[model samples]
Every structure is written in structure tokens, then in C-alpha cells.
Target chain A: MSGTFYGLGVGPGDPELITLKAWRIISHAPVIAYPAANGNESLARKIAAPFIPEDVTELAIPVPMRREREPAQEAYDEAAKLIARHLDDGKDVAFLCEGDPLFYGSFAYLLDRLAGKHPTVIVPGITSITACAAQIGRPLAARNDILKVLPGTLDAERLKQEITGADAVAIMKVGQHFEKIRGVLTELGLAERATIIEKATREDERITRLADVPAGERPYFSTILIYQGSEAW
Target chain B: MSGTFYGLGVGPGDPELITLKAWRIISHAPVIAYPAANGNESLARKIAAPFIPEDVTELAIPVPMRREREPAQEAYDEAAKLIARHLDDGKDVAFLCEGDPLFYGSFAYLLDRLAGKHPTVIVPGITSITACAAQIGRPLAARNDILKVLPGTLDAERLKQEITGADAVAIMKVGQHFEKIRGVLTELGLAERATIIEKATREDERITRLADVPAGERPYFSTILIYQGSEAW
Candidate 1:
């Protein structure tokens, strides 16, 4: 019988935010796989470190930081082949993801490659949207309100239209595109209602108003939440 | 000093899906509060049952089922007073919430009434959006793709507009509004791309394509995920 492959969501930065189901799977899995960007340590591994046994076999897939998709696609293709070997040998392999695996997580690459060929299971975890909302102590959406999750990489015009239409909005991946997103929100007269939470649930988490962030400063691993609901806080 | 208040998300439906942070706080809480719909057992309490100590004081707030806001507001007002009494006595109160508290959760009602008066912490959990996506083995959104979370209670015309604009969409609270949402998705030629995950992560969880569900049959505790991105599954 082929071994089962588990895609575990380690959650958004906080070690303790991982689900009990993920914890159990990570603790006992014979093989562990996670994405590492170039020379940087794997954030998913760091989050799941406490639960991972020291003797477990580690497979770190080196993901390149690039704009084009070919390099990353090749990396996932190679990693899938390596993970497939373990499953063929009847060894369960667990792939750790930073947030809920299917919520903008890189685990999708591997899932796409290995799902049909192997038995698979996915355990969801706390997403950054909820984690950032928790840090700000505000509801993202309530009652009949619509919540929009936009990538900051989107064009300014698209951002403005989405923000204008939604009651609550969470703009993510706000790296260099922070200025563009801020410009759009300001144009829509929503700058005051937006709050940026950087590295939420982490030890060095920072929360700042969109209007207060320094000019030209781009914070990665950050999410900006805008509340335009009836009970805007 | 008054005892701190905690809003813990216990995850969608599975008991084991609760995060380690939520479990820790729940296990050690002196007073645990949860919202119950009239005489219905508190879903949050049931989700966190394993961690809850037998002798822990439980405050079951009776949330009435009504469209009007006053009756529910009054219930929360009364519940807030009782929870405040526990906080005043330096008893740490952990309010259990289903999924993430701020994401269309009733815990927000209590948080609004009590946050300024007490030190509060919110532990995020696995949302139904991610859980449903995980169950169906698909990413909710990936790599700059916009994701919209809409309430099924929204008017059909408004739902059509929102669905048309996003690359990925998750329609929640699909009880009586299932037909309305299905109609919108079908009209947009997205019915084939949609999947309904009912009570994801639970033992009785069911995954049905939009085309397979019977006419006039509505499933509560369900989410409809529609993907229209370039890499749509």
C-alpha cells in the first residue's frame, strides 16, 4: 500500500497557532517536507519545530525568489519526485505550510503534483486574515457584510474598485506594493480606516495605521485590513 | 488587576482542528463562555469539549434566533454583564467561538461590549473558507489572485456582481440562500467550477459538485467555493 501524504498547515508565524490535528501528524510523520526560500530558513519548519521529532527525515525544497514561474515550477516538480519516492516506499510524508495550505500557500504546488498519485490529506490552520484581525481586535466581516482578500500586487485601479465595493477588505503580500495599495485606499477616502499588521502572531508583531507608516517603507509578511462596515472600528 | 478575556476560535467543526493556543487557554480557563442558540447546545463548547475541564464554570449565553437586532443585542448585553462579573473577580474568562472570532462570529458582539474594560486576547482558528477548500483539495486563491468571501444572505444581483469581479469566491452561510447562490453561479457559467463542502473536517462531512446537489435541497453548515483563476481546478 502507498503511504499517505499529509499537507499540514502550520499557521501564520505563531507556533501555537497550528491545529491539534496538524500537531499530531507532524509529531509522528516519518518524513517532513517544507519550502525554503533560497538561503532563508523555512518558516513552516520553524513554526512546527516544537512538534517535529529530532530523528525525522527532513526534505527542504529550495524555492527561488523570482517574478517568473518557471524556476518555482521546476523546484516543485523536483520536490514532488523526491517526496514520491518516500510514499512509494510506504513512508508517510508530511508537507508543512505556513498558513492554511489552500489559502495562498505554496503547498499547492506539491499538492498539484502528488495528489492523484498518492493518498492525501490536508489539515487547515489559522490564516493571516484571521490572525491579523485578532491582533487588531476587530471583526473582518459580520452579518451580511462581504469580505474581500486582495493581493497588494494588484494594479491600483483594481484595488480601488474592490475596496470600494466590499464592506471589509484584507490586502495581503504588501511588500513593495504597499505604496500602491495605500495610494488607492487614500484615493477612495479609506486611509483612516485601514490598519497594517506585520508578522502577526509572531514575537516581533507590529500594528500600525496605514496613515502612520513611514514613506517608502515596505513591510513584508504584512496584511492591511480595512473596515467600512456599519460598525467600523 | 482584572482577569484577561480570551476569544478563542475552536475551528470549523472537528474537535481536533482547534489550535494548540486555543486548547491551552481553554484547558486552564477558570470561566468559559459560549453562545448557544436558544436551547441548542453550544457548538463552540462541543468543539472544545475534550480540553474543557469538568469542573470549569461555563456561562451559556442564550442567543435567540431572530432577524431583528434588539433581542440578540439584549442577550449579548446580559451575557456581557455576567462575563464582566467574572473578569472583575480576577477570573480569566475564555469565550469559545466557532471558526475565527472576528470572521462573522457572534464573539464579536461580546468583544464589542467588553474589550475596552478588560485585557483581551484572540486566538485565530481554521476558517470554513480554508477548511472547505482543504476538503476539496484546492487552493482558495494563489499568487495575486483575488479571493472574495460573500455571505449567501446577500441579494442575488449583488452576489452576481461580486462573483463576477473575483478570481476566487467562497460563499458562506448557505442555508436557505443556497438556491440564490447556485442561481448566481450558474448564471455566470461557474456552476461546474464550484464545489459545496458541507460541515468540512467533521465526521459527516460531504463534498458535492454544484451540479449534483438535488433541487430544493439545502445543506446548513456548508460553504461553496468557486475558482476561476488561471490554474482553476
Candidate 2:
């Protein structure tokens, strides 16, 4: 019997944010896999550690975070093959992902290679965008409002145009590019309404105004959201 | 001593999609409030029913869905006053929401009145957008790809502008305006790549290519997601 491959999204930092379906599948799966880089622990596995069983087989796919600097094509290629072995033996394997699997998540790479060849299921998780919006205690957008999610890696000029055209904006992957992103928001007079959320839904979560966060190194797990038209506190 | 007010998102249609945090708070809450319309049972309340205690007090705010025919302000006002009484008595109240509460949810109206006056916390939920994307087994947007969330209620021209300007789009609230939205997607040559998902993540969920759904009444819990570069199945 060929086994099923489950792509489970364990959600953001908090373990409690994981859904019931994800928890159930994770706790009972015969084998599990998650992304790791440079021997660092996978955030997805950490968020799900409380629910994962004690005896399940574990595999780590070394997916480099900085894909631009170090291509990880060969690593993913090898990981998919190893995963196939477990499935061929009729052992179900659950691939854990941080956040929603298909929303800018690393799981997409694995899914692309495996979905076409086997029975696969993608279980969605809560997004950090919604988590940040929840932490802000304000609606991201209302009726007929436009929401633009632009990557911070975009050229500053294009970023500006996209930000200017939307009613609510969430800029992802805002690592060291915080200053440039903030500058664009400042130019658009949205600096005050903007919020920098780090590790949202976690115990040590920090929320600050864009103006207050110093221009320096930012945490890898961070996002900038602006609900324009509201006066800054 | 006043108690905290929790605005929890129970997630889309699947009961298991509710987060552990939401379940914990809802189960322990002294009073539970949810939005109901025209005597129809509240979807949020239904999603959380398995976790809710039998002895807990339930408050149904009759928020009419037909805002054009019957404004909902008066109903919300009355509900707020009733909720305030619970807060005034130092009893913790948990307000349940269908999707993410801060993302175009009915809970926003209550939060607008209670947020500043009382200590409130917003617990985010799994968005239907991400759920639908996961069901389709494709990335919503990756790398520098732009994601635009445009409401189907927008004027045809504005909806067209927003849809054309992004690499990926999720058209929400696709009720009676399905024809217009479908027309725009067809004009943009994206109909072949679009997927209509109803009640994602739940039993009896339906996923269909946008071009194949016959001309008929679309479900309110449905959304149309289009990944511009892909072909529809």
C-alpha cells in the first residue's frame, strides 16, 4: 500500500496556535520531516514538539534561508527522494511547516516535487499577517478595501508604488531591509500608522511603532503592517 | 476588578481548525457572544460548540447580513450594551468570530466600542484565503510576488484594476457579484487559472475551476483565488 504524505502547517511561534487536525496527524504519523539549516532546529518542529510522539522517525531537510546567497536545489532534491522511501514502504510521513504551507513557506518546494507523484494533503495554518493584525487589535481592511502584501526584497521604487496604491499593506521578509521599508512608509506619511511585529503570538512577542524601532538588525521572524488612514498613537 | 474580553476567531468551517488558545478561552469563558443573522444560527458559535460548556451564558447578537436592506448598527449597539453589563460585573466574555476577527469580521464592530474602554485581546484564526490556497496545493505568492485581496463588492472597474495589478489575487465575498467578478477574471485571461473554493478545510468542501461552475448562486463562504501564471485544472 502506498502511504499518504501530509504537509502540515504548525503555525507561528506559539505551540497553541496549531490546529486540531495538524496536532492529531503530527502526534500519530509514523515519520516526520521539517526544514533545518546549518544544523539549527526547525521552528516548525519546535512549535509542534509538544504534540509529536516520542518514537516517530524524524528527518531534517537542510533548506538554506538565504536562497539567493546559497542555492538549495540539490538539498531539496535529495530530501524528496528520502521522503519517497518512507512512502514506498507504506509508512505515512508528515512534513511539518511553519505558517501556512503554501504562503511563502519552504514547504512549497517539497510539495512541488511530491504532490504530482503521490497522495498529498496540505493543511493550512494561521498566517503571521493575521497574527500581527490581531496583536494590533484593528481590522486589516474593511468592506471594499484593498490589501496588498508586498515583499520587502522588491526594489524600493516598486515597493513604494505598491504601498501607495493599497489601503492596507503587509510587507513580509523585512529583515535587514527595515530601514529602507520604513523610509518608504515615512515618505508616504504612513510611518506613524505602521507597526513592526516580532514573534507574534509568542510569549516574548514585541510590537512597536515603525518610528520607534531603531535602524539596526531585525529578527528574522518579523513583519511590518500598516493600516493607513488611522492616526498614529 | 474588570475582566479581559477575548475576541477569538474559530476559523473557517472545520471545527478542528480552531486554535488551542481559542478553545481554552472559549471553554473557560463565563459569557459567550456571537453574531447571528435573521434567526440563522451563528457560524462562529457552531464552530466552537464542541468546546463550549453547557452552563456558559450565550449571547446572540442579531447582526443582519443584508446591510443594504437593513442596517445592523442598532443591533450591534444593543449587543454592546449587553456585553458591557457582563464586563461591568467583572465577568470575562469571549466573543466568537467566523474567520480572523480583525480581517473583515463582524467582531470588529463590537471591538470598536469595547477595545478602548476595556482590556481586550484578539486571537487570530486561519484565513479562508490561505485555507483555499492550501486546498489547491499551490503557493499563493512566493518571493517577491505581489498578493492582492480585492473584495467582490467593489465596483467592476476598481475590482478590475486591483486584480490586474497583482501576481496573485483572492477575491472575497463572492455572493451575487460572481458574474461580474468572473467577467473581470475572464477579461484578464485568468479564468483558466482560477479556483473557486467553498467551505475550505471542512467536510463537504467543494473545489472547482472558476470556468466550470455553472451560472448560479454562489455561496457566501466562497472565494475565488487566481495564481496568474498557472493553468486551471
Best by TM-score: 1
Clashing pairs in 2: none
Badly placed stretches (over 4 Å) of model 2 are A67-71, A217-219, A229-233, B67-71, B229-233
True lDDT of residue B111, candidate 1: 91
C-alpha lDDT values of all predictions: 0.89, 0.84
Q: Candidates' TM-scores?
A: 0.97, 0.95
| Predicted complexes: DockQ each | 0.71, 0.61
Q: Per-prediction TM-score, chain A only?
A: 0.97, 0.95
Q: What would the per-residue lDDT of candidate 2 be over residues A85-126, giving only the tens digit for each residue?
A: 999899999999888888877777788778888899888888
Query: Which tens-of-lDDT digit does each residue in B1-233 have in candidate 1?
Result: 79999999999999999999999999899999998887899989988998999999999888776643333677788989999999999999999999889998888888998999999998988898998988899889887789999988889999998899688999998999999888988999999999999988888999999988999999999999998876732
User: What are the clashing pairs of model 1?
Assistant: none
TM-score values for chain B across all models: 0.96, 0.94
